[model samples]
Target: MKTLINITLLSFAMLFMSMLNAQDTVKKKNGEVLKVVVKEINDSQIKYYHFDDPNQVLFTLDRMTITEIKFAYGKEYKEEESIMTDDYFTEDQNMVLSLSMSSMLFDAIIISFDKAIDPKSGFQITGKLLGIGFGPSFENWYNRSGFDLEVGYKLKFSGLKKKKWEYRPNHLLSGRYIMPSVGFTTYSEDRSSSQIKKNLIHLGLKFGNLKIIQKLIIVDYYTGFAYFGGSKKRTLNSYGSDVDFEYNDINAGDLLGSGNFAVTFGFKVGLAFGQYGEQKEKLKRRK
Candidate 1:
């Protein structure tokens, strides 16, 4: 009788141990751990039920919030190990403010704003404040003023799933892209004897690579060509001598020129604001 009682107790203990081993464990990023019976897992979330509850009430949690899951059958799923197949950009990382370095060479400050519509595409606008920098001061000879505006559509060709598990999460707008742009520029120089006015309309296509550093700084390098069409006109006063009129050549190191067709190549450097800026501030506070 004593042997039988011991045997029966051992059997019950083994059954309880087996039941405990059948449960799954969920670990959250916030240091919470839960024992559950996993029901389903999709791309964005996971569905599960409490292992200890009698009613088995279902619960759902975002996959981003979870760190890992240890299954009952000795399998494991880690959130960090999963590959991002689509939509790599977050809402906070979608907008960028930048300045063109090459534009400063032409005595202009070109400020650009890019807003991402989706993970793969976006649009940008650039405003040029001409006659600000110290490229070639025309103040001694003539007063110069101009306005330039450009709008472009960007098609991103990176960070998408070309192969399995090939995307990096921090690569926001860091890759190759093709941009088609249209721009208009107008300039007027006022002198005592003559007034010179020039206008330009250009359509361009650019291929570029954008690189992001520390999730905040951006460097963009591009080369392309533009077709320019406009008129450069001068009005002469009574005292002014009228010779063969020639327009001031728009030349940048023999690479960019003013004519029917112009070659365009430049680099831009700037900081990414919005969410990335906030994150940098938070890190400073923590330190």
Candidate 2:
């Protein structure tokens, strides 16, 4: 009787151990099976690992392309803030925020056109005009997106064996000073419509051609010039309206009216993001 009772207890223990091991093992539909050690399960994804690869793999909630991933952990977002304290934003979010702080919302009517004449000398012809200027504000000036056109050219004396396009690295220099003509003001008379000046500087790199046929290993980086200055603008007349151009003198910043011109100086840098077109693929083949 004692022996039988011991045997029954041993069997029960073995069964319980087997069940526990099974819980730890997860089988996928594919025959390429991977044992899983379940960690913490969340509403979004599952945390586990294969027997061979001990790395903690996180599966997405929707089962996206990635087969495994680590747990989605870290940070939160608030209503008023633009950048959040999340791992995903650690890379480029801060730079974008910094740009927002420096830029002021303003009314700007600018037209710029650039033409590329030589692919070897790394030269480009450019022309720009700004009329009916305004203020520079970023807080509520989202309606201000500018229009610019740029063309690049390169000239190589003996590159690509006399091929139409020669591939090499090049640079271009640019500079400007811009005065914002628009911002939050008490009255219309406090600011003028056109007496605004802006400053800008650009040191361009990677001015060579990236044509497919003449493709060489390509890598380049250009830094924006360190810029500093405040923005201000005042319009004397409403152009056609009966609005007066004089400040009430209560909240005006120093200058008021058209006759009273203020020297508002600002500096701007240029970093060309990309200058490619839809027909870019085809153009790469020849030059």
Best by lDDT: 1
Model 2 Cα shift for residue 185 (angstroms): 12
Candidate 2 per-residue C-alpha lDDT over 97-136 given as tens digits, one digit per residue, 9 for 90 to 100: 0011112223333221222222223333322212124454
lDDT of 2 at 185: 26
Best TM-score among the predictions, by candidate number: 1
Worst 10 residues of 2 by lDDT: 92-101
Clashes of 1: 0
What RMSD does each model have against the real structure? 8.2, 20.2
Using all chains and alpha carbons, the TM-scores for the candidates as numbered come to 0.65, 0.23
Minimal lDDT window, size 10, model 1: 247-256
lDDT of 1: 0.73
* Candidate 1 per-residue lDDT over residues 26-106, each given as its tens digit: 998678999999999998789999988888899998776777899998999877655554344542465678888876666
Error (Å) of candidate 2 at residue 115 is 30
